[model samples]
Target chain A: MIAAVGLVLGIVAGLIYEPTVPTWLQPYLPIAVVAALDAVFGGMRALLDGIFDDKVFVVSFVANVVVAALVVYLGDQLGVGAQLSTGVVVVLGIRIFSNAAAIRRHLFSA
Target chain B: MSRLALGRLAAAARPRATRGQLVAAVLCAALGFGLAVQVRSNQVAGLSTLSQSDLVRILDDVSQRTARLQAEARDLEDTRAAVTGGASGSRAALQEARARTRTLGILAGTVPATGPGIEFTITDPKNHVHADVLLDALEELRDAGAEAVEISSVGGEQVRVVVSTHLVDAAGGIQVDGTLLHSPYHFLVIGDPRTLAAALDIPGGVLDVLHQEGATGMVAQQDSLTITSLRPAPRPQYARPAPASGR
Candidate 1:
């Protein structure tokens, strides 16, 4: 319940404030958001499994965003930024799908 | 079964796992914020939603369009310059041809002339004046730059004097180009009046020599005179225009 409240509050604040993302971060913000979504799904699956850890969840969230941005930055320097960014999204998307399936099974028990 | 389910639900709802729950709440908040911000920015900057390859394709299309339009504009400018230049060039040539025609028409004596000149009246009561004496007077006025000349008798018989005009001493009259006339003769001349009058009054000139023939010549300077006599322009049968040479 508290997490749901926090999520709603954050969305409302983001919509109202319209924070300006810096130019250097423009390319990475969407990727970072995708990685964060993957982390949330994984946390939900862990919670359903009765094995959610506070430290692990927080670390994974931060690490997922940072690693994704760094890979994209390296790809830009290597002149294959578009292809590499696609690879990152694909991997995070797979993870989010599997975790979501697991959460659905826990909730519906089917 | 209901009691066991109630006990398990109460345990799960207890605050024992509060630390992890708090962390989960914070992470969820961050996730939601990033999602909302990304969505908003995507709406604000429409191009940000496109992929890198898509943006490159768009840029290529725009640049190619711009280059083609520039070339088209240059072509139009060149055509406009050529059209205006040709129009002006032809206009000047037309004006020059018109002016040349006017000058040629005047010089060919196909048109009447008007200017200041002198009228000479010779009194020949006994008809002692011959064709040679009249010719000398005509020649003298011509030498004084006479532009146009005509001779008329006291009876109003007149002839336009041109380069081909011939004077003959006919019986009882002077026949000028087959037109016979008796004295007193009036020569209507068109030129500088002062010059023509002086040319006639010189010692031993037409006026002085007329006295020996028992004829008296009177000169009157006039401010303006109109010579209405005109001659037909001759067309040459044998003469042809020469071909242009580079030199």
Candidate 2:
């Protein structure tokens, strides 16, 4: 219960968080949020299925945050935050699909 | 019957552990709390360092603001061009004022600009008197050594800064191509910040009037400031005539 409550609080903090960014680089928030959610749901389902080890969960979480932030960083470098965010979202979407399918098959016998 | 009993005994011997579940739950909760603290600290830090960007961004925003100001100055040249080319009338004057007003909206935010400059930000009009008194304040910043100024609505709404000299719509919106601006004006000046401060303090200046009128405005000086670049927007063009119209 405490863990759930802490998770809730962390999520709220994330929602309210807005890092100082240039005016031209404002569209990455949505992509980051969606990618984060994809990771959480996919990880949670994998954990329930007993197939997602602690190593995989930790690795995925780090990659999600780092990759999302890296895209923004690269976009800022390339003078194209919007474009980088779009690319990041595309990659995350693909991962989500593939991961969800694997988890589904693992969790449920067809 | 002997085999089934033996399997049941084996299952009982290796029942799942509650200790592991409890440990995982506690660890997860600790991680969550730690993340929350980090996020809150970051938020506070982010606010304090407003417009904070990486080095590349810092340079980009400065250049962008400079380009935007240069673009407006070009608009002024266009006005001069039109006038010198013998374009004159109430229509031209109205068009020029409209263009300046739109530029004013965009200029409301202080772009990180360097090279001896002052910045003044005027909060929104709380009353009719305050609203009526803003033009004088704008003049003060200009006389104080401000080369360019922008007056924008709160948060630089679309109505606050349009890119063109086009007439403001009835909604007090400046249209820049398709962008609009609305208020909470920021006036940026690109000259000696201290000299500009003195200019505003000159006897019988608008600052004195505003002090008497009880309006709110703030002026600040910076050794180094950078304004972020506005993302490039699509250029507007005249619509092509249909075949029927051409005929």
Candidate 3:
């Protein structure tokens, strides 16, 4: 319950502040968001399974975003940025879909 | 065995969510908040412009200005060449002035011009074609060194297209300079045929956009393309050339 309140507070703070992202980090923003989404869905699925681990969730969330951004940065250096970004998005998208599906089944039993 | 039953069995055997569950839920919410903010910012940054037509008009204005600058540069180059040609006599001067006049006249669309170039026929069945699309094609042609361009409906009278021409929406199609152009808009451009054709065929170019929007754009290169249409000389009411100091 405290966590839920913290979550709501974080969302409110984010909306209120509406901070600007730096221009240098602009290219990685979308990829990081997708990675974060994948992590969120995974956490939700774990929670439904009654095996939620805070350490694991935090680690996965940070790692996912960092690795996704790193891959894109490397791709930019190699002159294949667009192709690599597509690859990352596709992988994260599939993960998010599966996790969301599992969460749905756990919640609705359908 | 049903998958749901097996999932239930596995879920029931696992320990109940601990205090860590709260942390994970909070993180998830934070992630959601971040995603929302990111999406909103992206939208605001990308589309602060008013509407599609406004964007197109801005692009058209920029391209027309670029074309005008390029024409001016070409004129300067011709004049420089004439000055450096070492023709000192009055006859040479007269010839140079006449040549410059012809070149400027052609560029200003006040004189007819014919040469090798490419022609385009765009057939829009849905009449949803935008004037900016045609203007983009003209810009591409100009960038590829097109000297003259004339556009008309396939069966209608052609008009000389100038940098200052405005394309307005009509009942059935578009109206360029008071002439209602129907579908299958024909464009005759005089330039390097290879360069002009390549410009249209470039990947993700004008042709690709037209194709994506359900418009059929076709280009054909010709050894000789004639542009017979002419624009009348502008009679400036308030602006005149500055008088020469010695005169």
Candidate 4:
């Protein structure tokens, strides 16, 4: 119960705390946002299994977080935040589809 | 009944685990641990990073991006040179070069500080380039292989330039909207001087017209030109026009 609360609060905090994304990367905001959600799903999947590979989970988690931050950072930096965000959204979309597939396979496949 | 239940419980305790379940278990544990760490780090780093000066980070990011852009611009310039020099009369290559040049030009116009290039001085008799004229000049220069262009007196009422508009002016001078500019009408255009000059001089061009009108326009091919951003003016948005009805 405590952990769940902490997770909720942490997410809320993250939402409240704005990242310093560049103007050029503004478009990627949705991408990062979506990617973040996908990352959480992926993270949860790993967490659900008792035998978890820290390496895989950590690496992907870091990549997802950093990339999200980077989309904003580089976007803000280049003044093409929107354009960069578009690119980020494209990448996030691919990740989302892949994650969704994994979820479907895991939950539904016999 | 108690003894039988005890025996079954003992047997169930030793039941074999499936590989799929085993893998899932491990993965889930790992994710739990990793998430714990991610949360911690995010809390620490996110707060710290946010608390830190964003402007400084922004400047650093800008500098790094500028370096990358400059390199890319140089690469494009070299490719263009090689293509032109091959003189294969390859329409495809020329077209590609032209297309890339225009794209780069538009990009450079958007981020004037990104590349190492030249400067241009466009003098307005009234101290401003007409909207149509400014856009024409910018497009021509880009087509001519200008990697970047900076106009003066941008970022104020005196100057305005967006993707749609051709002309921009400041209170006293003109700007292309990326950088605040001043006159003797300095236009910092970055690219190959000779080729760029020829591109501007194409038959029946804006440059020719400007020249015919005795406007002060000079293109200085430079080893390097610096483009920096000035404070942006508050952007304007359109509202519904009020209807005109007789009271």
Model 3: what TM-score? 0.43
What are the per-residue Cα lDDT tens digits for candidate 1 across A1-110? 56667688889889988897777888798899999889878877776777767788889999999999999889878878888899999999999999988777776655
Q: lDDT values of the candidates?
A: 0.84, 0.54, 0.82, 0.56
In candidate 1, stretches whose alpha carbon ends up further than 4 angstroms from where it belongs are: A1-20, A30-110, B1-77, B115-130, B149-188, B210-225, B244-247
When summed lDDT is taken over every stretch of 10 residues in candidate 3 chain A, the lowest stretch is: A1-10
Pick by lDDT: 3 or 4, better one: 3
Model 1: residue A81 alpha-carbon error in angstroms: 4.4
Q: Write the per-residue lDDT of candidate 2 for residues B1-247, one digit (tens) a residue.
A: 2443334334423434445433434444434543544455456554332233444577788899999999999999999988876656767888999887655434543232235566666553543234335546655665565654445454674222223323334245333334454345565556678888777767877566655656555778877554443434434497754687545
Query: Which one is best on DockQ?
Result: 1
Per-residue CA lDDT of model 1 for B1-247, tens digit only, reads: 2443334434444555487678777778877887898899888988866657669989999999999999999999999999999999999999999888765644565677777899899999878999999999999999998878889897678787887788999998789988898899999998899999999999999988889888899999999988776667879899987888874
Q: Measured against the native two-chain assembly using Cα atoms, what DockQ does each of the candidate structures obtain, in the order listed?
A: 0.37, 0.05, 0.14, 0.01
C-alpha lDDT of residue A109 in model 1: 58
TM-score of each: 0.60, 0.29, 0.43, 0.29
In order of listing, the candidates' clash counts read: 0, 28, 0, 50
**Residue B109 CA displacement from its true place in model 2, Å:** 79
- DockQ score, prediction 4: 0.01
Which residue window of length 10 is worst by lDDT in model 1 chain B? Answer: B1-10
Residues B1-247, model 3: lDDT tens digits: 3465456546634554666655666676676667666766777787332233445668899999999999999999999888777556667889999999999888889998989999899999988688888878888988999898999999897889887877888888888988888888999999999999999989999999899889999999999978888989888999989999999
Cα error, residue A88 of model 1, in Å, equals 8.4
lDDT of 2 by residue, A11-81 (tens): 56545663343344334444545555566556655654545454565566556766787777777677776
On the 0 to 100 scale, the lDDT of residue B198 in model 4 is 72
